[model samples]
Target: MIFTVQIKVMPLKDLLDPQGKAVMGGLQNLGLNNVSDVRIGKHIDLQIEAENREAAIATAEEAAKKLLANPVMEVYEITVS
Candidate 1:
């Protein structure tokens, strides 16, 4: 079976996100002061070949942990469909 994997990679909450901060600054400059603590993250989409949904989820989780996200600075969430 073929599975669709969706992964979201984001900076750890305790870590500083320069890109997000830059965007937030830009937004505030544009007079969007109501928005606060903006965060930016990466979305990854890929197809995986697996025997079942459970296997596909496991594969994607492993991929996220091993290659897609940096454990030190980033956290990842995986969804398989």
Candidate 2:
């Protein structure tokens, strides 16, 4: 069966996100002060061939851990359907 997978990768909370911080600073400069702690993350959408949803999810998780994210500094989540 073919499944659709969505992956989200982001820096760990304890790590600094310079790009997100810069964007947040820009937002404040534009008078949008209500927003805080803005974080930047990556979204990946792909299709996979697997025997079942469980297998799809497992494959997606492996892909995320091995290539999509830096396990040491980033966290990843996967959704399969």
RMSD of 1: 1.0
**Candidate 1: residue 74 lDDT (0-100):** 96
* Residues 25-80 of candidate 1: C-alpha lDDT, one tens digit per residue: 99999999999898898999999999999899999989999999999999999887
lDDT of 1: 0.93
Which pairs clash in the backbone of model 2? none
Single out the weakest 10-residue window by summed lDDT for candidate 1. Answer: 72-81
Checking candidate 1 for backbone clashes, the offending pairs are: none
**Candidate 1 versus the native: TM-score?**
0.92
Task: Please report, in order, the local distance difference test score of every candidate based on alpha carbons.
Answer: 0.93, 0.93
lDDT digits (tens) for residues 34-69 of candidate 2: 999999999999999999999999999889977999
Query: Which segments of model 2 are wrong by more than 4 Å?
Result: none
Per model, how many backbone clashes are there?
A: 0, 0
Error of 2 at 64 (Å): 0.6
Cα deviation of 25, candidate 2, in Å = 0.7
